[model samples]
Target: MDIHAWQLWILAAIIAGSLEMALPGFVMLWFCVGAVVASLAAAVGLDINVQLALFTLISVTLFAASRTLFKKAFMRNASTVKTGVEAMVGQEAVVTESLVEGYGGTVRINGELWSARPLGGPVAEGERVIVEQVEGLKLWVRRPAASLEVPLKKKEGR
Candidate 1:
């Protein structure tokens, strides 16, 4: 029994499309397109060689076009936002030690000692400050806009 050219093309298209579910992306979409083209060629009474040639050309062109279009759509904007300690902008903390210029100083933030720096004015020990920015492993800090001044203790009557 002889199988028709159109039957072979239709079989190839179904197999290619089914394989795509197991794999990922548009890898098999092009092959399915090629099979359809081959089937069309067979319907027009084209010889087996011409059908094969058309299939090859359509498959390659579709694969290349899909790859280019997918890259532009998915890969161009795939960057993620920084989080955790890297996202501590504008946070407030207290200086656990004095911050001298050009030296690493320690600040207490969220019950942790973090390497810190004075962005402008010197930050004394126990002073409340706000995190201005982050530079490498250190945090640039500044004094808060207002301070919570504690009242002095009163002396007992003589």
Candidate 2:
């Protein structure tokens, strides 16, 4: 049983395409395209060196040229969907334990309790604070601006 070079190239293309699907990011797609082009070159009676060279060139060119396009099209939109602790930023949490200045306490956000520290002054228990940043098992929080506003004075004698 004799196997042709083009058949091997097609197999490589299939494997690369499958790998691209299993992995994250747009990494292996260029190699899949390159293998397809190499297979076509082999079908046309091109020399082994020529087929290999074309595969390398096509893959590198597509990877480089499409990098920016892929980043703009795909990576840009991905930032809009944050996961894990990153999503906690800007969310309001009630202080479960009084947070001393420069010290950490507990806060409840999304039904989960988290160790938190104040970004400015200390936060009292039962006060609402906004998550500003997250640092390994701790959240930096600040009081909401509206809570700091002064109330209007009532008119003298009704």
Candidate 3:
């Protein structure tokens, strides 16, 4: 019984494809196709060097092509994923304690005390602050905008 080079290539192709199925990332599939192409080259009486070259060329071409094609056609990136406390942005919060320079403060948001830091300068305790952003485990807060506040006026008749 005489075994041929193309026969070995065919077996390698099958193994590569099976490995691809077991661990998927679109990675091994191209190599499997390359092995098949190499087998075809062997069948066509091409030299061993040429067949190996064809395998490498075909595998690389397929892998690179698929990377770009799949990324453009299927891959999606979330523009914004506001998870946990980050979703509380723009919500009003009450300062639990006075915020002083060189000292951190706490705010009550969603019935929870959150460590906060003033934006421009420190704010006093019992003041309303807007959550501007979150850094690490602390909240970056600022005084509530006047537009969002109701102005107090003196009544003409009291």
Error of 1 at 147 (Å): 14
Measured against the true structure, the TM-scores of the candidates, in listed sequence, are 0.56, 0.55, 0.63
Q: Report the C-alpha lDDT of model 2 over 1-158, residue by residue, as the tens digit.
A: 99999999999999999999999977799999999999999999999999999999999999998978878877985746788888999999999999998778999999999999998898889999999999999999999886566889999999
Model 1 residue 13 distance off true place after TM-score fit, in angstroms: 1.0
Q: What 10-residue stretch in candidate 2 is worst by lDDT?
A: 72-81
Q: Going through the candidates in order, what is the number of backbone clashes in each?
A: 0, 0, 0
Residues 38-136, candidate 1, lDDT per residue (tens digit)?
Answer: 999998999999999999999998898997788788899787676877767788888999987788488988788889989777878988888888877
Error of 2 at 131 (Å): 1.5
* Ranked by lDDT, top first: 2, 3, 1
| C-alpha root-mean-square deviation, each candidate | 9.0, 6.3, 6.4
* Model 2 vs. true fold: TM: 0.55
**Model 1 error, position 67 (Å):** 5.0
> Which candidate comes out best when scored by TM-score?
3
State which candidate, 2 or 3, has the greater lDDT.
2
